[model samples]
Target: MMSSVINALSVDIEDWFQVGAFESTLDRADWPSFEHRVERNTDAVLAMFDDAGAKGTFFTLAWVAERYPALIRRIVAAGHELASHGYDHQRVFTLSAEAFRADLRKSRRLLEDAGGVAVTGYRAPSFSIDQQTPWAHAVLAEEGYAYSSSVAPVRHDHYGWAGSPRFGWRPVDGSGLLELPVTTARLAGRTLAAGGGGFFRMLPYEFSRWAVRQVNAEGHPAVLYFHPWEIDPGQPRVPNAPLRSKVRHYANLSAMEGKLRRLLRDFRWGRVDALVEGMTA
Candidate 1:
């Protein structure tokens, strides 16, 4: 039987240099010195999505939106949702409640104003909303965000809220916001990332494909994400990073776009706003 579940295909709108992996190596102040490749790369992805007749949410950086307003508008013009990735690409856990709230409010306002859409979604940088930051969900709700795709639910050194739900839910303690975690598949009682970013690049396309299918078979939408840089294998490569960081950022760059195209063709996709339509509160 054809699965009725519609999966989310999302793009994080930040320049290659703005990725959290490179944050220690490059400061926000130095971001201007490095050439940014997000606009051109996102245009390419937008073209591919246009060709596939696909629409997905874009969790965009406020810095990118402030500088490249037209790109965010183009994303909305293409019929995708516009959401916040916070200003400056800072992680939720790194900031205090007041600081996090300020960042969240500012970024949401900027995204909505610049993109000409009601920005209702957020995804913390590096999926860093975890046990350390229980206040993250409350702030998201208080600041008027309707949903967040900010938890990975798997354990990792940098991020991931281990043992969290794989699907969507409002926090028991939080007031209004909902959580749409990144897609994951359980095997032998361990939760493995289903698809997107480094995982998508590192895994065989077949594994990524099967993982999302398994989620859809369970009648839930799979929330998958990627970045504009993932498709740009020709992008300028940064030098002298830690070996692991370099591997995670650059692995299988040439093959990323093709896999994304296949995923688009193989399944049904749409904006996150649509993905939650008729969803229970």
Candidate 2:
């Protein structure tokens, strides 16, 4: 059965080499040396969404936007929401409150200027906001961001708050900012990652389909995210990256587009801003 709910779809607009998995092997200073495939890959994503007649958010990095202003314009021209994914893809927990604020301001400014739209939504790199960054929400509100999708409420090795709210809520007292967590589904008393990522590629498509249905059956929108690099199987590989990172980054790269197309056809998807407005309304 098709879900009556309209889920939120998002693309984390970054290149293959810029992923966290390659952070150890690649340095920020040498980022310019890598082959720039973000434009080509994101164009593929936009084409897919266009074919599906879907409009979603693009959580763009200022680094990418600064280098590829034309790409930012294309995203905006296609009627997708342009949101911030920070300046350089740094995790919130890794930065102090002041540094985080600085990142927020810089990213929001760069993205807004590049896309010519109000950047109000943020998704921390790697879903990095958790209990340790209790002040994050307050800073987001102060910085004029209306909402965030930075928290993944599941137990994971890298980034998950585990016990955070499963849906959108005001994380800070007296603040209107909303934290829209990446979707998770309960199965056999365990919280599993239902949202997109390497997990979506690693796990069977049937499981993801069931998970989205599970969330929709409960009367909430499923927020799914994926990077442009996920569909690029021919991307240059980092030989020095750890085996775990390589597996996570390389597994099912060729299969992502097909899975994503199926998911889009199976469920209704829209921008996160629309989802946030509906939840608040």
Candidate 3:
């Protein structure tokens, strides 16, 4: 691994049931009734980061922050960056401009108060920021977020900002927000999604590794993200999940931790804030 190439590592901190996969089957009000696996699962991730001597950003939900204040503090105490993952894991586009602004404000306050640190970064739930939600950038900047890693350029059914930049760039029509789309790679003249999530699990681990290498070789920082649930195979399953949701959410779960270990060992990992600072400098 090249010592100079430090990629951004992030985790979207939400419980298994809170994931969008169970949106159809699980109701938000019923969240309290389900098992709260985020604390234990996130601690497992913290231990992995410690073993690797790596730091990352945790884009945690305010709902989770209020319920698990100690976990937020624990992330900060371990030298990891903490950022808002919005108030209730709702998609940004799904909310009105006023609603999104409120979400950002409330989440930032909760995270900052709980983590005892400034929250300057955000990642929208499920990367839901798109052209329809251009107002999001200005609102995010106005609310004091310094940067966002919320848009994936790839075309997915639920979310995507197709033709967006794969690396960091400022919006021309949106706002002064510094946008860092998920890391991707060009292969055979077509851009492929490489930044972790379900894609990281669905694809061969070696392919994910190569995609990051490809991005770095092109002199761009690769930003990889994962959910703590992705590493916990034994998590309670969302029974009666739709076929598509089941396939994407449960694919190769048992093998994810090993791939994560390889990722931490094969590349330099750092916080998203560090990358932003470097870019600004």
The whole-model lDDT of each prediction reads 0.87, 0.92, 0.90
TM agreement with the true structure for every prediction: 0.97, 0.99, 0.97
Model 1 ranges off by over 4 Å: 172-174
Ranking by lDDT: 2, 3, 1
In candidate 1, position 31 carries an lDDT of 88
* Distance from true location, Cα of 234 in model 2, Å: 0.4
Using lDDT, give the best candidate's number: 2
Model 2 off-target regions past 4 Å? none
What would the per-residue lDDT of candidate 1 be over residues 1-281, giving only the tens digit for each residue?
A: 44567778999999989988888887789888888899999899899999999899999999999989899899999999998888998988889999999998888888888888788888999998999998888888887777889999998887888899888888846365788899999889889987488999889999988898888888888899999999989877779777788999999999998898888888888888777655742
When 1 and 2 are scored with TM-score, the better candidate is: 2
Query: Where does model 3 exceed 4 Å of error?
Result: 1-3, 172-176
Deviation from native of the Cα of residue 170 in model 3, angstroms: 1.0
lDDT of 3 by residue, 137-223 (tens): 888888867899999998778788889888898864555569899988888878778889988988998898889888888888899
